[model samples]
Target: MTTLRIGNASGFFGDRFSAFAEMVEAGVDVITGDYLAELTMLILARQKAKDPERGYASTFLSQLTEQLHTIAGSQARVVVNAGGMNPAGLAEAIRTAAHEAGLEIPVAHIDGDDLTDRANTLGLGTPLAANAYLGGFGITEALRAGARIVVTGRVTDAALVTGPAAWFHNWAREDYDQLAAAMAAGHVIECGMQATGGNFSFFTEIPDLRRPGFPIAEIEADGSCVITKPAGTSGAVTAETVVSQLLYEVSGARYAGPDATVRLDTITVTDLGDDRVRLDGVRGEAPPPELKVSITEIGGFRQEITAYLTGLDAEAKADLVQAQFAHALELSGLPRPHNMEWTLARTDRADANVQEEASARLSLVARDRDPKTVGRQFANLLVEFALGTVPGFFVAAPPGEASVYGRFRPGKVSQSEPIHRTHHDDETSLTIPAPTEFRGLEPTSLDAHSPAPANGRTSAPAGSQTPAPAHRSGTTDVTLPLGRLFGGRSGDKGGTANIGLWARTEAAWQWLRSELTHDALRRLLPEFADAALDRVELPNLRAVNFVVHGALGEGVAYGARFDPQAKGVAEWLRSRSITVDADIAGSVNLDDFFTAEHTPASASSGSDAAAGES
Candidate 1:
């Protein structure tokens, strides 16, 4: 049996490159790198727009160039999804670096995933808002090319390794089961340092972080792999922490399509001897039909004004300023139709004493169609508001200091764009060109904001993807009625609700938007129903993000971890209705929210809305 001892040099985007050398020294069969994130993608796209030549950093490629010969000589393979938006460009750079390094070793350029161009070509013609998808074929072709190292684009994080193992062992093309097993392996190791201890929840106990060992994957031919830090490393790899990391890998809720998902529960974990855990039994379904499209346009200008408002009776002075600012906004001569929210922040400290500089900071955030018009008006408004007030002055507020915030318009891409892919018919048989003279290229210093570290120990610019590779094979229609959106017994402090819903690409999202924003989904609830949906962020999973602001409406999430109000809101919602199951965390969850109560499994079949009414 060919021992494919896969090693991991880096976990997320920004990590240490020196670990690649350490993995080489440790004698692993292969190495993998993961790099990509939603916010990070925008960040990279912005960088590329600013300077195409500068967007794709040359650090990792240059490092790989220097060690290409050693890695090729050892016959060890390397897999990386370090290719973000510029996969082809990154590969070309790496190839050039390899040629310069005097390493005539094989360099397979693997990448073809850019949904931006095909966003609306595949039967999807909506106002595009956001775009994000994991890679599949990018990883496969890279490894298939037999390059000493394989670099890819925004792989589902798991697809990075799944692509390689499937190609290496020559698993059947439709063998999604084996493919998923490999996907699990990639998911476990993608967060290079996190799998070890960087973001470990139990990090307080982990010792010797300075020389912390990155994550390594021990894969058996059966498609199972155990993720563990290096032996003799300071951190401990327990099932508890690994399980947490596994869940942490899958972020938010939504990805692009089905087949693109990597299910978490499918993994069978068996702790082996020597602090190693053998993970097996990863399963997958088909992929979704549509792709996520992201379009960024110019929003209005925004500036955060932070100043110390110190004076006698600071709280009382701040209150007077707030009242005076409101009065000026009401009559500031400039058009006053613009919406402005002024908040007097209450500082949280051990002592309830008010600070001498207690005052309000105005964060004027506006999103208008025209930046120029808003900027000019904002300049007049800021000065007018300050001039009308008798409490304080800004720490040198200027006219053009207002920064422009980019507004991201998200929608679905055409299904025909082929956003999600695995392996395809190409290899009939190719052979790696024989190793020739290796010429090393000049090494480039890593950018401070580079997502990942030097060689393998780097982090991604956008951190990395949250690992929630569930079954994304088929798209099923789902319609959450107005009632189901409200009510839930959660652990929010003052009755708040943290809700999550899973949907297919059919009319699920559209229907949801209708109910929540357009159709008054919140009106369905009666008691403790006066709540606002604070933030709607799409993290990792191909799911919905609904974080209620005040009532905790039912539970606590990103805003409030465990506020009593949010918990009460969730429980109240649960008591009032039944249909969607709750995935609530914290101490205030109602034990009976998910009892035998369930609504129509198929929402399309019914027209009646089910409410979590108590």
Candidate 2:
């Protein structure tokens, strides 16, 4: 089969709108967009509650509506998870939009991924939405039936690319290696500009990031592919950027999808030069018997208040603010919430400087089953501190109204259940078959309580502890920030967060693996000392990924922590000074070499740093 060029436009629901048009103009064979994340499902469910026709990603349809002719003319097959909780409704909306535009694109919608009924049995609160992460088989079937555009609800992100690749290569269920390769390619480009330089640790090196081009994967029949962007796009694709993204939010050596189990240990990345990173040697195993099901349900109400502390004694002032607030709450005779978090973030820079630079923040968050407890009463109690608190005291912003939040619960369902169905534009639909054999694929990082492998390399699941690996020995040593020797990337998966740390060289990797043991990690971030923790080593990528189970306390939307999604987890770790060999610590040349070795993919690009994580 010829090489398949797949381009990804939108990473999340509200991604760059111009990406689709850019992919279309770039002449991609297939265009895809990943519009769903764990929290996004809950958001969509809330939207569906307001209006049944409003559940799907409006941006997906808007992109298609604006670029339907361009996409149809370029002979590009469009696939997106924009269907959210309503794949049928999204498909119908697209069909209607296409008709109004005087176009007749054959659109297909994949169904049966919704597991609301099955989830109800667990009694896991009032479910907002229950979705099973589906595979690419239905998409392949839809494409076989001549679907110009395919809409899916909750398929794995990589399935967007693997589906087309499977259809193009006629890959069977047993073609594990090839399928694994395609899945790797999909994973690389799935997050749009992430394959470029969006959230790279060494962001100073990449140039022309003003508007980075969306990522494209050029995959061959063998499964090896070059990850790149449009020729004139802003961001650059290099080994470091690709590796950074590869480690983002991943658990261990294995990355499981509904279609296959990809072994990250064997994955290899090579700089093919000229804005391309060749990905190869991705191996695969049979997928697990049960598919992952995301269950989002109404948790309760939450409210937060922040007080600013500046200049001398900022930490002391923050303490006073918290004390006064608690006293006020007590004097008001108001019932306390179920849970409360008081955090004093010392962002104050050292030495004499502007007050803005010396300012610290004291934040208080409350969660409860009753709205009144976390609502106006909570806000009023915080304001009472303004008069009696320390000097230079002020609220960062108004204590806004309390908001409803959703709790994320990860579960599994037998593959045989949740029948897969695909509806074609020609008024035809069919049930896609489930694999007969139970592959018994080990559960994903979702099962934080699972025992770790006996190898002692990965963390002891979440609650368990493992013996610490030996620390590296060196005669001459110096103290420097961890970022001096390692680069890191981190993000959330439901209530869990994974931080991926990598070294530039083999020697560095060895030192990192030895020095960054489970015990070392706990020492560095004592805040999560008791939180469930697991570490996975990826020697092939010179990286180690640490999964913090239940770190976010119910997930981003529901979590009251300041860094809810753990976006700053890696950055925070990097800022901590660590002892290292004097030679390694002083090797500014090594850092300089890396800066120049990997060129940016496109013109200087500007991106919303926070939103780029997903």
Best by lDDT: 2
- Tens digits of per-residue lDDT for model 2, 113-184: 887866767443348788889999899999999999999999999999999999988899878778888988
Q: For residues 472-544, what per-residue lDDT tens digits would candidate 1 score against the true structure?
A: 3463323223223322112221233445332222133333333333012243333223444432222111123
Candidate 2 global TM-score: 0.90
> Considering summed lDDT, which 10 consecutive residues are worst modelled in model 2?
602-611
Pairing residues by index, what is the TM-score of model 1?
Answer: 0.61
